[model samples]
Target: MKKVLILSTALTSVAMAASAEEISVMSWGGAYATSQIEAYHKPFTAQTGVSVINVDADNPAAPIKAQVEAGNVTIDVVDLEYADAVRMCDEGLLEPIDPAILPAGADGTPAADDFLPGAVAECFVATIVFSTLYAFDESKFPENPPTTIADFFDTAKYPGKRGMRKGAKVNLEMALMADGVPAGEVYALLETPEGVDRAFAKLDTIKNDMIWWEAGAQPPQLLADGEVVMTTGYNGRFFAAAVAEGKPFKQVFDGQVYEYDGYAIPKGAPNMERAKEFIVFASQTQQLADQAKWIAYGPARKSSGPLVGLYQDGKTEMGPFMPTAAANLTNALPSSYEFWVDRDAELNERFNAWLAQ
Candidate 1:
């Protein structure tokens, strides 16, 4: 009896040790986090017995920087926007991720070649190509529905409160686009003093009626709760609400600003090896494609494109909803990471000053 008791105690301790292994992934919450949970976390835990604990943030970049700078890094993995990833990597706040660790495409192409251009960075591995676009509650605009970027700015014609992100990046670009600046000319114009003034001048038109949102999740909720008739939000969030939840929201791809969002290990991560494994598993071709079923964001892997099928409901095709869809690209702008890397600080200062007025 004594021998049996000793063996039982030893077995339980081993089981507890195995189950205690977990990695923390910080990401933008709401529907986007759900997608990662379904497509990445669950499968990863099942395969490796290493659990994933999700940490939500309005934007993970700010917290990550703070964590790294303070030398108390709690998060093992972080989802970062492209420009933030580049900036943090340059500042040595993130661990260097070797592309060689990533698996090849389903078609057996090398990861370096299989990934979309700029998808694999020195310290980041992009998972999706998401777009920031404006969405409207269909019931709010039953007649003469908005169809252009300019329509989003026409308060007199639309007659409702507008929802926008409380940041300068997309707002400035969208303002220029609405003011009739071509997609190709937006960045060039933004570099000039007169152009920066012009963009703000356009925003001044709707400043009073603007309902600013800082999180990706808030825009859809603002529209659903009738706080705003039209709002800008991530394409995936709107798609999740409109399709999965059966909301009457409609997205306008016109003047959409699309960029890559992906995973990076924070410097001095406690679970560095496991974090790398999670990133490799999450960014696999099939895994990337599977994420599309849960959200409208395009997979970063080119091979994943053909494998993308229907939504989780198994009816609505996801191709046409992707930001990379041919029709949607007709009037879209690929976000410029280089431009943001150079001007984020100064422009944000100007934006904050304008907000105070």
Candidate 2:
């Protein structure tokens, strides 16, 4: 009888292990992924007994499209930029996510009303509002640090290597801004052919001095390694290096372009229902607010704001560091998703041609 009981227990153990479910999530790595792992993945796993696997990419959107088009979808949930999310949804590459699945805010507000404008879309639910901004190593410019977007392009003044993302999106807008275009008028100017030429013209000035980086984590590393004096990067990575790791990096918010980053399930995700459940859990007010504790990005849900307090360090407040903070928005530009969605391919093609030249 004891032998029989042991056999039954072993079989049960194997069955339970086999039944355990796991979902793969693809996101931009570095401090950003750490934030999600702590605030969303850990708690979600604890609550549901489902394992969460993280996959890192320079950008999640391309791999998602590739996997879906090839009809061998491996990633269950993917973090996406606002423009990519909208573009993919339009192409029917993402599964439709009903806002009804999200829970009400901690303050008892409904999900639809609680989420900031454009946070909830047909196939995407935004989790945080992040920004792309340039930061310089203070040690690199001890006397007169760069204070404006124009300084980023003034290779003659700054006189050092600069790091920039290997993409056209934020670079074009910043080029226009550095060339003296107002934040509100950037997209309008880009709509004209002359304006496109002007933006590219500005970029040409610093082309030789620029060290192109494609990954979110590369900027901070480049600055630390002294590969570049200044680099445009996501704000949170810089925050982690400076405040958390005691790096001498300082961020310049002038000409910053802020936008939303969110989660979506690819069409035909193997674990579609479970992926939906994970998104619902991650987008809740508390989870969103908790994410702010680890990174500087603002929570997308309005109710999540009040819950955002000190950073993980326990003393540093997160409000002033957020891209949406009042002080930071003085010359900041909200990235126009519509403009990118419409012009992405055309501009990128031109950008690639320019790069070749």
C-alpha positional error of residue 30 in candidate 1 after TM-score superposition, expressed in Å:
0.6
Q: How many collisions per candidate?
A: 0, 0
lDDT of each: 0.96, 0.95
Per-residue lDDT tens digits for candidate 1, residues 1-357, read: 999999999999897676449989999999999999999999999999999999999999999999999999999999999999999999999999998999999999999999999998999999999999999999988998999999999999998999999989999999999999999999999999999999999999999999999999999999999999999999999999999888999999999999999999999997899999999999999999999989999999999999999999989999999999999998899999999998999999999999998
Error of 2 at 69 (Å): 0.9
Cα lDDT of candidate 1 equals 0.96
Off by over 4 Å in 2: 1-20
Task: Please give each candidate's TM-score.
Answer: 0.95, 0.95
Tens digit of per-residue lDDT, candidate 2, span 1-357: 999999999999887565448999999999999999999999999999999999999999999999999999999999999999999999999999988899999989999899999899999999999999999999989998999999999988898999999989999999999999999999999999999999999999999898999999999999999999999999999999999999999999999999999999999998888899999999999999999999999999999999999999999999999999999999999999999999999999999999999
Candidate 2, lDDT over the whole model: 0.95
